[model samples]
Target chain A: MSTVSHNEITVTGLSIGYRHKKKEVVIASDLDFKVLKGQLTAIVGRNGIGKSTLLRTLARIQPALSGIIQIKGTPLTAYRNLAWAKITSLVLTEPIASKNLTVFELIALGRQPYTNWIGTLTASDTHKINEVIDRLTLNTIAHRKCFELSDGQLQRVLIARALAQDTQIILLDEPTSHLDLHHKVSILKLLKKIAQETQKTILFTSHEIELAIQLCDKMLLMGSDGFPFGTPRHLTDTGAFDKLFPHESVTFNSETQTFQVRD
Target chain B: MNEKKSYRLPFFLLTLVLVVGFLVNISWGSIHIPFEETLNALLGRPTETDSWQYIIWNYRIPKGLTAILVGAGLALSGLLMQTLFRNPLAGPFVLGISSGASLGTALLIMGASFFSGVLTQGLIGDISITVAASIGSFLVLFVVMTMASKVRDTMALLIIGLMFGSISAAIVSVLSYFSSAERLQRFVFWSFGSVGDLSWPQLTLLLTMILLGSILSILSIKVLNTLLLGEQYAQSMGIDMKKSRFILIVATGLLAGSITAFAGPIAFVGLAVPHLTRQLFNTSDHRILVPAVLLCGAILMLFCDLLAQLPGSAKVLPINAVTSLFGAPVVIWLLVRKQKMVF
Candidate 1:
């Protein structure tokens, strides 16, 4: 095997899906990609295209149907649960169980893996949490309850939680789904800044393909015919974006670098 | 953190109030002993009336201790259940623990009469009933947990827990139908729930269970906090779901089961105390909430016991009834005023 420099996550010939008892439902297959360090990657596709499933598979929230997910050159299954947690942090779109928790306390939970037996936050833990809060610019709302936060603010707080975990890789599932266009771009920009500044691998599943194309360093475009993984320009030049949605409904305008609604 | 300071004052006040509540519980009972005399008896000094000594040392003290154990155990288990199931409504009663104990006690005190009607009412020892109830609660919890492991869904487990309660309740009803009228009366007394008749040995056993359950709850604080993320995110953060669930179920069983075994399923305390504590404490971190439940539970139960005693009258209200009569309204008031039940 060649030494892939700065490769944080590498998936080869990967098949992702669900298994019910004996039957295997393969959602996507033959996915091969390299998620580089210090880069923001996006998984873009139509609904039910297994973009979230691919992210979950890479995060090991669920098992892949077949193929290898190598995290920093080691098989994902080879690491224990704790070891995997120390390397990759996950942010789901699902709401937290309790909204009574304050912003600071909730983010402090991301330090669970490193905390003491009783989950007490030591000096270092507090320092790390403060650094994350400051980095994410959540100072004003740090004392507010989660219920007090708006969707955009909550999304930032959730991202702050993942960052506080101090993992090398972060995976998010449709992070910008419910937010408006302004928030979606703000979150993407924040993610890009975080990935570049901290040298962490960040991948998120998003429906905002136009924003993703403008922001992401790499994109994994999911399709039934074939999954293409590359830089946005490379993928665009190869005419992949035009094949994303149905041409009758919408088409990609390569000239303006955006998707246009058809008449 | 400065926030830790704000909570510390409330915690200190709650502990102080608990101490005051305990002494008040001892001071005001069917027989009136002055607070100073009660303090003397508590301090192992001589009291003015010898009957006061006998009553305080022999009855009130043990009764108070039993109330504390029962209250703390139930409330801690309730908090554990709420956190484990991630449902604000979950508690020992909802999970069938109390009913399981009822079934065990029914099987022993009444089910035997169904077989031959040979054994007299006083023939069975108090210890035997306690043992039977403990076994019953643990067995049912074991079954619920086994299914939880298989299903891997918290909501389904909650439904299964309710179903177990219903099934045990049905069985208890059948046993009641077959037993003699005297046996039926005895079972009814047990169901009314008492904190008074526990002997020293029964108190010791209940104490052991409370100790172990509290220890387990302390150990589970980290896991419980993680669980607040919902199980999936918790699992993603390196929490072993099966192992954590098993420990929590065991802790809940020990606390809920043993209290039911000794005290006969005193209602309302387990479910109400956690909400009350959360309302006051203003945070869900189990590190604070666990010990907070211990004090809040004991304080609330002791206060309720004071009301049950009725101070001047020798007649006592059933603890189970008194708990609901007083506790339900307070919880309702809190929820109505706050516009939310603190989870």
Candidate 2:
């Protein structure tokens, strides 16, 4: 256990934003955090806080403006595309237009890094995909096309795809955007269970802050005061969650570790 | 995966259809050749009529093969474009390869017409038309490909392709206005499109290009599958999007370009066969779609050529017209019946 448990991700002095018209726009800067293996972490913030940007930067979809991102003690910049793909994968919020692909075929695509040029999955690739499918309880829908799946079922299948990549890290952007409260809780709970069982360092940007605080082992909070990275209870105790949004709309109550609406 | 075996039945069905279509196509032209005679002539056995053997060997067989090659090549290219662009409406000639070919012949025939008789109808050779069309399509394809790299958005690239095609077509229109009526009619005839009268050397060249394009497509099956998740996901999966886009564009160019060069702008088959194949297979897996599309394209083209032959009638129809006249209704019916068009 001691040999396997370590910091899977370490961000130092990370600044995330985009440049417009030759002007640098920094959404959040000087942010530092570490994600341990086998933990579910969340980056929660209000709208337009660059939560997706931070997640995308970690996923290597975009380059960080000025900072260091380390995955498994190696610099993210140093890892090549193929090597990085084997180490991490993404579950984007954008719906894929290819809704005609069956669940099994879509999930099987996660084996791209491991498969040959023609993508003929080996027995091991098949085993991994099937294992992930089983783990996600998708056997019933494996033969169904993606268009047939409900929002929740599709979310689970998307998670299954990321899991099937067999990477050490998984990054998702808004894994529960369009689902109901029940579906969101179930999806987040499923993510937590997979992290606990597989030792994957799962991190996702989400608007479901309260749910995330309850399910996540760690959280990185983006607020008006500054960025804070810690456990939910610790951040709650430090009043970091209190400054996330305007008090006029909602208030964070530390005693119950919940957000209360204002009159 | 178990899905591997699932496609074999469909493949068998399509192959059966393709074989029947090919035989029916080669047998029932204006001149009647019976089944026994066609089969015997194909097998190189002694036939009752020597003329039947010559017609079967020299005319019908080559024409049938050309139809098959043209169909298979255009369909494969369409699938590539549709997947790459992520557009359901995309077709093989979306890059304006056919239009570029048309412009090339226009420039050759009419570009010299008003200027001088150095390259008049008397002097213009079939080889020259083929070469000119090849160069024209290549030029337009080059511009589209160059834009393909610089532009990040695929939809923008699609628009650029349309625009580039329009620009060249506009150039052709301007060229046509200045030409003599006789040369204009000849150029118009070239645009009508045909799958017959190709010399052996031309057929061999078209075969070579289609074969090369298909091999490239097979090699890209993995990339295509990865791309179904979207380009960002594909890149996250270690696929270099620029390189993948370049490869896809080149393969599409090879197929669409050569077909237009040899067969003229044989339309609709490239655009519609993929949708038809999707409805048939009900999956986007290229492993199945690639082979399935090849067979389906060949079947549809052979049948379209048969219809164009107008069986037992002296008059023939332009293949370009027949493809749409015959294909659009089938595609429309399928899409409307299923109430879903697989993108």
TM-score of chain B of each: 0.95, 0.96
lDDT by residue (tens digit), candidate 2, B31-112: 9888988899988898898999988878888899999999999999999999998888899988989889988999998898
Q: Count the backbone clashes (under 3 Å) in each candidate.
A: 0, 0
Off by over 4 Å in 1: A1-3, B117-125
Model 1 over residues B5-38: C-alpha lDDT tens digits? Answer: 4577878898898888888888888887899999
**What DockQ results for candidate 2?**
0.67
| Per-residue lDDT of candidate 2, residues A72-116 (tens digit) | 888899998899989999999999869988899889989999888
- Candidate 2 overall Cα lDDT vs. reference? 0.89
Please list the residue runs of candidate 2 whose C-alpha ends up more than 4 Å from where it truly belongs after superposition: A1-5, A19-26, A260-263, B45-54
For residue B303, model 2's alpha carbon misses the true position, in angstroms, by 0.7
Worst 10 residues of 2 chain A by lDDT: A1-10
